[model samples]
Target: MSSPKSGGAGWLVLLALLVLVLAVASVLVGASDVSMLALLGIGGAPADPMASQLLFASRVPRTVALILSGMAMAVAGMIMQMLARNRFVEPSTAGTVESASLGVLAVALFAPELPLFGKMVVSAGFALAGSLLFLAILRRIPQRSSLIVPLVGLVLGGVISAVTTFFAHRHDMLQSLHAWSTGDFSAVLRGRYELLWIGFGLTLLAWHTAHRFTVAGMGRDFSANLGLRHGRMVALGLLIVATVTAVVVVTSGMVPFLGLIVPNLVSLMLGDNVRRAVPWVGLLGAAFVLACDIAGRLLLHPYEVPIGTVVGIVGSALFLFLLLRTRARVG
Candidate 1:
C-alpha cells in the first residue's frame, strides 16, 4: 500500500525530526546549565565564564567526537557484519577494543612521551591485528550456526580484556585503562580530540567504497564470478574498520554497542542492500550518539555521567530487548 517515494519521504521526515532534536539537545547540554534560548543567542551573557569556556572547549569537542566516533563504529559494524555474515560482529564484540586499549596502556606505561598520533598508530595496528586474528578463528571454526560466531567473538574479546586488565593491574595502570575502557567523553577538550578526525576520514572512505562492499559481501565465489577481487575488498574493509576503531578508542574510549546496534537497525529498515543502508546507518549513528551524550550531560546536571556509561547502560538494555523480541518472533 506504500510506494517507494512515500516510504522514502516518511523516513526523511522522521530523520529530519530526529536531527532537530539532537541539535537542540547537543547545544543545551553540559555540566553547567546553558539555557536553550541563551545557547541560541537570544539571551544575556552566561553567569559563569568557566561554564561558557567549558561549553566551548569541552562540550563542543566531545559532541564532535561523539558524532565522528559513532558513525565510524557503526560503519565498521556494518562492514564486519557483511564480511562475517553475522549481525553481531562489531569491533567491540570482536576484541578490537580490548586490543586497542592494551596498545594504549603499553604506550601510557612504557612510552609515555609518545605523540598522540603515534599512540593512534600503535593502537590501530593492534586493532587490525586483533580483527585479523578473529577472522582467522572464524575460518578455523565452521560457521554452520549463526549464533556460534558472535559467541566466539564475545569469548575472544573477553579473553583479550582479561589480559589487558591483568597487565594494567600489574603496572598500576588499572585506573588509566579503566578510564579509557569505559568510553568517557568528559575529557574530550579541543586539543585532545583531533585524533577522531581519523575516524571521520574512515567513515567517508566507507561511504565512497560502499558499492564494492556490497559485492564483496556476497561470498567469495559470487564476487569472483562477477569479476571482483574478494581478497582486495576484504583487506580494504578490515583496514577501514581497524583505523576507525583505533581513532574512536583513542578519542572517546571503548563504546560497546554503537557499532553493533546501529547497522542492524538500518538494515532492518532499509533491507540488506548495503548502498541504501549506508547513509541511513550514518545518520542514525550520529543521532544516537548525540542523544546519548545529551542524556549523560543532563542526567546528573552538575555531575555528568560519562557518555560511555550512558550508552553502555542504555544500549545493552536495548540490544537485549531486541534480541529477546527477535527470538520470540522467531519462536
Candidate 2:
C-alpha cells in the first residue's frame, strides 16, 4: 500500500488533472458549436463568427467564474470548519449567505443605481458581521458535541434568511432576491464575472494563513499556549470566509454544497494538515463545480438547470451520508 503521504500527493495530482479536463469540457459544452479543433489551430477558422464570439465572450467568462467561485467557496468552507471545529459548518449554514443576500436586497431597495462594485462591498460587510455573530455564538456554546455548532448555525441562518425574505416581500423585490440567491453561471458575461477574481485573491490569502488557521482549530487554550494569537487568527479566517462568500453570492448566487461538501471530502481523503490540504481542497472544489456546471448545461439540453440546483442535490446527498456515518461512529 502506498504511504499516506504518497497517497495524498497522488490524489492531488489526480484532482488537478480532473480540474483541467473539466475546464476544457466546460469551455466546449455550451449551446453554440465552438470548434475546439479550430481554436487549437488544428483546423480552419470557426465557420461562424458567432462561434468565436460565444467562446470568448460567454464561455470563457463562465468557465473562469466556475473555477474561481468553486475554489473560493471550498477554501472558505475549510476555513469555517477549522475555526468552528465543526465538519458541517459552512457559509450557508452560518448565516453568511443570508446576510449577504440581505445586503444585496438593501442595496437594490435603497440605492437601486448603485454600481455592482458598491453592491459587493455592502454585501461583504454584511457577511462579515453575520459571520462574527456566528462565531460569537460558538464561543458561548460548550464544545462537548461537534454537531451542536452546525445545528446552531443552521438555526441562525434560517432566522436570517426568513428576515430577508420578509423584507424582500414587503419591498416587492422577492423575485429579484430569488434571482440573486440562486446560483447560475449561464448569464455570466465578460464584465459581469470580474468580481469573482477578487475571490481568487482571497483564496490565495487563505493559503498564506493556513498554518495559523490549523493552529487556531486546536481550541483557544491550546493555540494560545503555543504562542499564537488565537483571536486574531480566528478573525482573519472569518474575514476570508465572509469576503469569499459575499463575492460568490454577489457574482453567481449561493452555491450551497460546493463549500460544505468539497472540504469535508478532502479532509476525509487526506489528513487535517491545513497547509497541505489547501491545494487539494482548491482543486477538488474547482473540479466539482465545473462538473456540476457541465451537467447542468447538458441535463436539460436547450434549457439549463441552474448550477446551484445541481450542486444542491449532490451536496445534500453527500451531507446526509456524512451525518449518518458520523452518527454511526458516535453510536
Candidate 3:
C-alpha cells in the first residue's frame, strides 16, 4: 500500500488537475462558441475573429476571477476560523460581507463617482469593523460552545443584512443591492476583475503567516507563553479576512456560505494546522466554486444560473450536515 504522505501528495495533485480542468471548462463553456481546437490552432485557426475576442475579453477574465475569489474566500475563512477559534465562523457568517455591502451602498449613495478600488477600500474598512465587533461579542459571551459562536455571528450578519436591505429599499436601489449581494460572474471582464488579484495576494500572505495563526489558534495564554503575539496574529488574520471579503464582494458579489462551508470541510479532512491546511483549503475551495460555476452554466444552457445560487444550495446543505454531525459528536 502507498504510504500516507504519498497518498496525501497524490490527492493534492489530483485536486490541482481537477481545478485546471474546471478552469478550462469555464473558459470554453460560455455563450460564445470558442473551440479548444481553434485556440490550439488544431485546425489552422478559428474562422471567427469574435471567438478570440470573446475568449480574451470575457471568458478568460471570468475564469481568473472565479479561481481567485474561490481560493481567497476559502483561505480567508480558514484564517478567520483560526482567529475566531471557531470552525463555523467565516466572513459570511460574521457580518463581513453584509458590512462590505453596506459600505458599497454608502459609496453608491454618497459618492456615486467613486472608483471600484475606492469602494473596495471603504468596504474593507466596514468589514474590519464588523469583524472586530464580532470578536467583541464573542468575548462577552459567557458560554463559548462550539456552535454558539457561529450562531452569534449569523445573528449579527442577519441584523446587518436587514439594515442594508432597508436602506436599499428606501433608496430605490434594491435591484443594484441585490446584484451586489448575489455572486454572479457574468459581468466579470478583464478590467472589471483585476481587483480579485489583490485578494489572491492577500491569501498568499495568509499562507506565509500560517504558522503564526496556528499558534494563535491555541488559547491566547498558551500562544503568549510560547512567545507568539496572539493579538497581533488575530488582527492580521482579521485584516486579511476583511480585505479578501471586500475584494470578492466588490468584484464578484457575495458567495453566500462558501467561507463557512469550505474551511470546515478542509479542517475535517486535514485538521487545524494552518500551514498544513492552507494548500488543501485553497485547492478545494477553487475546485468547489469552479465546479459550481460550470454547473450553473450547463444546468440551464445559454442562461447561466448565478454562482451564488448554486454555491448556496451546495454550501448550505454541507453546512447543515456539519451542524448535525457536530451535534452528534458533542452529544
Q: Tell me the tens digit of each residue's lDDT in model 2 across 92-207.
A: 88889989998998898899899989999999999999999998887888644766777888899899999999999998888888887889998899999999888899899999
User: Of 2 and 3, which scores higher on lDDT?
Assistant: 3
User: Candidate 3's error at 308, in angstroms?
Assistant: 0.3
- Candidate 1 TM-score, C-alpha based: 0.91
lDDT (Cα, 0-100) at 268 in candidate 2: 78
What lDDT tens digits, residue by residue, belong to model 1 across residues 1-331?
Answer: 4433333756755775786678667866654666644454455654555556767787677777777777778888999988888887788878888888888988898899999899888898989899999988998985345667777888998999999999889988888888888888887889989878877788888888888888888889999999999999999999888888888888778888888888888777767877777767877888888888788777778777887888888778877876676668767
Q: Quantify all predictions' global Cα lDDT against the true fold.
A: 0.81, 0.87, 0.88
Count of backbone collisions in candidate 2: 0
RMSD (CA, angstroms), candidate 3? 1.8
Best by TM-score: 3
lDDT by residue (216-290, candidate 3, tens digit) is: 888799998999988888888888999999999899899988887887877767665668778888888999999
How are the candidates ranked when ordered by lDDT, highest leading? 3, 2, 1
List runs of model 3 lying over 4 Å from the truth. Answer: 1-7, 37-46
Residue pairs of candidate 1 with colliding backbone atoms: none
Better of 1 and 2 by lDDT: 2
Worst 10 residues of 3 by lDDT: 1-10
